[model samples]
Target: MTAEPAVVAPVLPAALRERIVAEFPKYPEKRAVLLSALHFVQDTFEGWIPQAVVPEVAALLGLKPIDVWEVIHFYAMFNSEPVGRCHLRVCTNLSCCLRGARGIMRRLEETLAVRPGEVTPDGNFSVGEVECLGSCGTAPVIQVNNERYREGLSEDDLPGLLDELRTRLAEQDAAKDEE
Candidate 1:
C-alpha cells in the first residue's frame, strides 16, 4: 500500500525553490535530484533542513515527499534541526583520526562544552563528527560551513577560531541590534 503524501507547505523563499526546481532536469533521475535539493533548502535556511519544505520540491517535480525525506535522513551533511550560524563538521575518518583528529575533537568538546551534534547556547557554533571529508592529506581537518581549513590543528586552534567566529557573530549581532 502507498503512504499518504505529507502536506508540507514550503517555508523556502520562492526564489530559492524556483532556482532549485530549475536544476532538476539536468539530473539523471528524480532520486539523484534530492541531494542537491536538500542542499538548496539548507542554504536557503541558513543551516538546517526542514522536512516540511520538501513538499514544495515534491510538488514541483511530482515526486513523493518521502523520497526527499529519505535522502535528507541518509546524508549527515543535511541537518534536520536548526544549527549554529556556522556549522563545524570535523572529519573523524581514518586519516584525520590517525593524525590528531581525536585530540582536536576532545578539545572542541571541552572548549565548546557541548558534545557532538549539539549547538552552543549562543547559537554561534555547532560541531559534529563526520566521516572522511576526502581531505585525508589534511588529517584532522574541519569543514566550517562548507569552507575547509586544514593543516596541523593544535589543541589551541579550537578556542582561538571559536573566539574569532564569535566576535564576528557579535559584531553582526550588534549591527542587527542597531537596526
Candidate 2:
C-alpha cells in the first residue's frame, strides 16, 4: 500500500486578514463582505480571483460555501484559474466593432501571440473580448486593471501600447517587490 501525503490549504496573509476583519464591522451583513474579500483576493493574486478560493472566502465571511462561488462566477473579473497579471478586456460589442475593434483585437492577439481567454507564456498579459464597458463614445477601448486606455486604437498602435503597459507593470511589480 502507498502512503498519501497530507495536503496543505492556502490562506490569505495576516495583514489582509486583519484588514478584512476591520472592515467586516462596516458591512450590515456578513454576506456583504463577499465583494470586499473578492477584491482583496483579486489584488493579492495580482488580479485574477479564482473559484477555488470560494470556500475559503465563504468561511471567512461566515457564509455558505456556495455564496462566494455564486459571486465569483457571476462577476466576469473573477477568474476560475490563474490568468495573466495584466488583463486587457477589449470591448467587442456593437459600438466597439464599428470602431475598428476587430482590427485592434487582431493586432493585440498578433502582438501578444495569444488569443482571447489565454495568457501569454510570460504571464505578463491576457486578453478578453468583453461586452460593452459603458464606453460607446470611446468605442474600441480596453480596460487594463483600473485604467481605461481609449480613443480609436488601431492595429498599428497596439505594440507600442502593450510595450508601455509592460513597462508600467514592470515598474509596479518592481516597486511592490522592493517593499
Candidate 3:
C-alpha cells in the first residue's frame, strides 16, 4: 500500500488547547470531544472552521484530520469560511416556505443588501438559506447567529429586525471602541 503524506498540525493557543482537554472527561472517549472541540476552535477562528483548524483538532483528539473534516462538512452549523459577525439564517423548507419564508428572505436581502451565502459589505451580517430549523410549528423562522430564532416572521417584520440588528451592531462597535 502507498503511504499517505504526513499531516502538519497547527499550533493552537494554550486556552484553546485547555478547552479541548477540558472536554475530554465529559465524554466516553477522547474522540467524542470532536464536536465541542470544533465549536471552541471555530469560535477562536472568528466563527468559521478553517482548513488549518481541522488538523489541529485532530491532533488534540487523537484522530485523523480527515475525520475532523468529515464532522465539519457533515454539520450545517459549521462554516468552512468566514461568515458575518451575525448570521441571518432563514428556513426555506417546506413548512417555512409555505408560510411566507420566501418573501421574508427577499425583504432581508433588500434590507441587508446581500444575497444568500454572502456577507454584507461591512461584515455585520450574512444571509443564508437553511433547511428545517426544527420549528415547523413556528413556520417561517429566522435564526440569528445560531443563538436565537425569531419565528412566524412576516415580510413587514423584516424592517424592525434589521433595525434591531443594526442597533446591536452599533452597540457592539461602541463597546469595542471603549476597550
lDDT of 2 by residue, 50-109 (tens): 656666778788988787777888988777677787888888999989989988888888
What are the candidates' C-alpha RMSDs?
3.8, 3.8, 3.6
Q: Residue 55 in model 3: shift from native, Å?
A: 1.9
In order, how many clashes per candidate? 1, 0, 0
Candidate 1, TM-score vs. the true structure? 0.84
lDDT of each residue in 51-150, candidate 1, tens digit only: 6777777766668888777777887888888888888788888888888888888888887788877888978788888888887776668878866575
Q: Candidate 3, 132: how far from true, in Å?
A: 0.9
- Which candidate ranks first by TM-score, i.e. highest? 3
Instruction: Quote each prediction's TM-score.
Output: 0.84, 0.84, 0.87
Model 2 — which ten-residue stretch has the worst lDDT?
145-154
- State how far residue 143 of model 1 sits from its true place (Å): 0.9
Model 1: runs farther than 4 Å from truth? Answer: 1-10, 28-31
The order of the candidates by lDDT, greatest first, is 3, 2, 1
lDDT of 1 at 109: 82
